[model samples]
Target: MPAFTDIMSDAFDYFRAYALRALCKARAMPRGRIKHLQLVVGRIYNLLKKEAAYAPNTQQLQDFRAAQQLEAALDRRRDDGSAPERGFAAARPGAEREAR
Candidate 1:
């Protein structure tokens, strides 16, 4: 059987990927959906933090910090109405004018 730390490390990696996908999805999501994703990211950040406390390794600490940053960025985007603009910025240069 794997060690407890190994199990935790695997779980951490899984949640980290999950959080990344959620963050990307949040960028294009509506405000209400972004709000829900923010809560989910917050939960994942808390989980990473707790794991860091138990493991105290460099990689774990870095992941915890990244999760913290991701949550903060999501909060900022949600509050500042930037999420909607992400889609606009990704459009072709003349797409906005053409749509108008």
Candidate 2:
């Protein structure tokens, strides 16, 4: 079986992707605001940190770093517009077009 750390990491990764999708496609309500996205990212970041504290190897550490960087960029998008492209780039993965 996969290590517990691996499992948690995968779960967080999926949730991060889902949150980004919601941010990108959110309409006039709950998901459209940067504040909402920021909140989600904050929670995810905390969870990621807790998992990384017990990360079994370097690979997991690297993955956590990448996720943290993305989370920071998302936070910046909530603050300033300089990272919009990166934020949107991260906000959507695996597609050239965003969902409507």
lDDT by residue (tens digit), candidate 2, 34-89: 55655555565555445654454566456656656766776566568653433444
Which candidate leads in lDDT? 1
For each of the candidates, the C-alpha root-mean-square deviation to the true structure, in angstroms, is 8.0, 12.5
Query: TM-scores across all candidates?
Result: 0.41, 0.33
On TM-score, the candidate that comes out on top is 1
Clashes of each: 0, 0
Candidate 2 ranges with C-alpha deviation above 4 Å = 1-29, 33-55, 81-100
TM-score of 2: 0.33
**Candidate 1 accuracy as lDDT:** 0.64
Candidate 2, residue 59: how far the Cα is off, in Å: 0.5
